[model samples]
Target: MQSPAEDSTTHAPTRDCDVLVIGGGPAGSTASTFLARRGWRVAMLEKDAHPRFHIGESLLPMNLPILERMGALDKVAAIGVRKSGADFPADGGGYNVFRFERALDARCDHAFQVRRSDFDRVLFEHAAGEGVDARQQLRVVSVEPLACGGSLVSAIGPDGPCSWRARYVVDASGRDAFLGGKRRIKRRNTRHQSAALFSHFEGVERREGVDAGNVSIYRHAHGWIWMIPLPDGVTSVGAVCYPDYMKTRRGDSEGFLMRTLRTVPEVAQRMAAATRCADVHATGNYAYECTEMAGKGWVLVGDAYCFVDPMFSSGVFLGMHGAEQAAGMVDAALREPAREAALQQALRRHIDAGTDEFKWFIYRFTSPAMRHLFANPRNVLQVEDAVVAMLAGDVFDNPRVRRRLRVFRALYAVTSLAMLPRALRNGLRRRRQSRVDFSGETLQAEES
Candidate 1:
């Protein structure tokens, strides 16, 4: 992708739109589709062309409803591997699978594991089909607030420089956090920081029958690993570890990824005969969130607003869900200027409500207590089912699920107290590990 820098001589005419969406990933596409369907003059700009490679490939059962709403579920399913649920290593050996059907809400019982290249293109094209003036390879260069209201957004595309006068802006630029970074509101998470290395592979052993498509997770001393079954007999395997452990790399990222996989007996066995089919990708210090989600004329959604961890495969769901909600909020705000503040506030609360629930578990995911509980989950007070619901991305507006989640948190607290000594040791280790520096590397994907 070319830089967003514009050439002075290539200026094109400025277009007018009700909403100018930056970035055409899931969030941007969904928002554009919804707005355009509502008769708004919506324009979406994407830095890269469709069918581009992206890392997050897993989807939760909760995502089914949204996809169905957008009329793209069938398309996604056709190109995806059927993923019934997720699984984790059991303390007593074997694996403990949490089927989506077992959750409190079983209506959306299944999801698909897709190659994001295909998945994202489907959504982007769907948006264009829905009347959005979607354009690719247009990197937004600047967004300056207009004195009369709205903003002027400029970009440089194949046709050279172009601009848009937009009433409201939707910043869905993924991890670039365009507006957030520009305003200096993006903050790296202090409590939890992590790095990852991943690649696609073939010949990796997959579970048979009903479990063949489940995402497998294994906990290691320094971090955790994920094995997502993608279509075409390929698996997306990745390890998310602390910066301290990642900084110990002795060679190339591929070697480091292979060595990390070998450390986990379960993953190593599965990948023993696997042949890498793609280049190894590396990313570091990815956990972060913007202090503000919205302002006078704009709102941020998906990774542009905040990102915690991808342990539960919430990235795509959260992004699309936020876009769905943001579209509504933006619609209402456009009609009722006096209510814009309240609408943006509600949007932030809505996104954060689910995010906070996930954060509680994510912050403690690598702890001994969390590992023990997950490995030996019980249905005591139906807490396990509630957890399954949470994992399914059902964290919003479910009273029954919320009640049980509270119980689960209490249970976790008591368990932590019981394992106080071990908990303390793990906490200290995590703190020390998080403080370790990796020079100055951020998220980056490279070839072999």
Candidate 2:
């Protein structure tokens, strides 16, 4: 994939659309595809070109229905490499492999891991093929909400400045919610603060049995590491560390990623057998939320509303879920005048649920005890199924997860007493193993 710097030639100036989707990530693509299918003239703008490189390559089985609904299931499946489940490898020799099909969440019976570059491109092409007017390299420069209750969007594409008007807008704009910026509604999350450094590689360790197609979570002192296998032989590896742990790094991504990976014995060994394919990349403090998810003339979808951490690969799942709601909301707003208000309210509620669903686990992932639990042997079939449901990203309509989430929350409070000895012993061992540079400030215990 070429860098934005390399693709300097913008397309000829253009305009006009019923719905304008900014950002062609999973959220934008899903929303745009659905809107276009609804017979709305949808035009999508993507700052980055398709086949663009990106991290976060894992998927949940529940997301397949959205792809199917968009008529891209076969296409996605073709490009997709099947993901049976996830595996957790801790500091000790213990490893846990979880298959979503084995869980109570029947929706996520299966999933996949695609190179984001290919995955994003597939979805974009699907949206365009579905008759949505869309283009890449069109950067949204300014968004002006008009007095008539509409919006005027000025953009800088491969060419020069151009403008377009829309009666209503869908901020399907992934993480960099352009409209959210204009609304001055972006808010940072304080719980489970973290940073990440990632890169792709070939020859990374993968289980040959049922584990051959799986994601591996390896624990480290600073935090944890993720290994995702793609359709191709290459595997995606990333290191997630607390904000304080990152502060001790030399401020260089490649060095930081390599250094952090080396900290985890399992990840270090697997990476040692593999080779990096590109420059190491890094992102920081993964939390952002908008004040209101919906408005008089627009609604937020995907990361436009809020983004929790990527620990459970919920970004794509939540984004697709939001699109599911927005498709209905947008359809209603266009069909009936009275339903418009109610539609926006529904979108806001959807966003709230999406945020809470992901935030719950984001907070738990950082729990030292939780991490250890995955490392050690503890199997309550129901708890395993509940967690598998959560990992499946089936928060939408998952009464099982919601109930178990409550149970876990209460269990965590009580288990704090039982795990006190284990926590203290592990904490001290980790402290001695890694250089404790940060002040002894404990991380917050919430996910979102």
Candidate 3:
């Protein structure tokens, strides 16, 4: 088959826009919408159509402000299940619940649990309504940065081969990492390696009142499971586990997932009356980061630049926030070309700061000490409040919040030392589990 660049040569340039955005997920839509609102001509290409099924349905409280700013708050709220807190159930009959309202930032006291398909479509449509030339079923196959400036983006749309000479390119290409893959900057996150298996179900039990939409996390012997209640009464359930544990599956994905669900008491009890509503899905190597995020006339956003674990439901928040930051940087670059380097550096620093704050907790999530801390939260030095702030994605502009997190980290170190034996054993086991023998087993995805 002819390459995207080769095919582009055969067809005339279909269109031109000031900014060309690849991927129409949270990141792409947010960037496109923001640029379009600023009176910049923007064109977005999405490989898949909207309303498509996707995992990572939970949303952080911090995402509310972004949505409100985009004029999508009411649209999203109409379809969302109000989520005020998070529930963590331990294997030893201990449970801890963290309410967003208790966080340092009171503005972001609550969020919503949504179906990604519906949530993403709301944002994608908002971008189009803002005058973005949003095209669905169009995949950006290759990007060639021009010698002088800008880029030549080649894509395959429903009409056939197409191309565009864009002044700037914003890559929000989810896990495809189009720009990162092309530049060979994509690197697996060795610190945390794991996979997920998930499916939706009807009849999963949920709490009453405001807690009905709270996401429930259950810790099992092997890993953890999340149960999120959607507006339509469907519950999204998934398990994140090590490759070694996943390799023991002897049957199809559906059977394996069902058997695994039974291993977690809370998840099994809640799912006992539930009926499967979707096909089983699996994705491996959950953590990755791109070495570079921005250059000359191009910038990477969302999962295109990096993806950490979804344990704290930070995926959507980070993606949308990154898009907002990248849009500002791109706007600045378009107006003041001389400051491009500084603007790019600022964007990189912004992304790194957000990811780094979450990385610490995610890296130690499965450790004995971290688990103990989360399972038995304390308010000494307002550490629990700081953690709640972090979970709410409030670490970006709050100096007071960051300081509290530092104190919490110091406390964690001291606690870990107190439980040295258990911490060491857990650390060793985690190290072994993090090393996956990819040559021996591939990622599994089976139908029910």
Model 1 residue runs over 4 Å out of place are: 1-10, 425-448
Against the hidden reference, what TM-scores do the models get? 0.93, 0.89, 0.93
| Candidate 1 TM-score versus the reference | 0.93
The TM-score of predicted model 3 comes to 0.93
lDDT, ranked from best to worst: 1, 3, 2
Model-by-model lDDT, in order? 0.89, 0.76, 0.87
> Global CA lDDT of candidate 1, please?
0.89
TM-score of 2: 0.89
Candidate 1 — worst ten consecutive residues by lDDT sum? 439-448
Q: Model 3: per-residue lDDT, tens digit, 302-399?
A: 99999998999999999999999999999999999999999999989978997899999888777778888887888988888989999899978888
Instruction: Report the C-alpha displacement of residue 257, candidate 1, in angstroms.
Output: 0.8
Rate residue 144 of model 2 by lDDT: 71
lDDT tens string, model 2, 314-399? 77878888887787788789778578888788668757875686686667665666765666534464776777777887666777
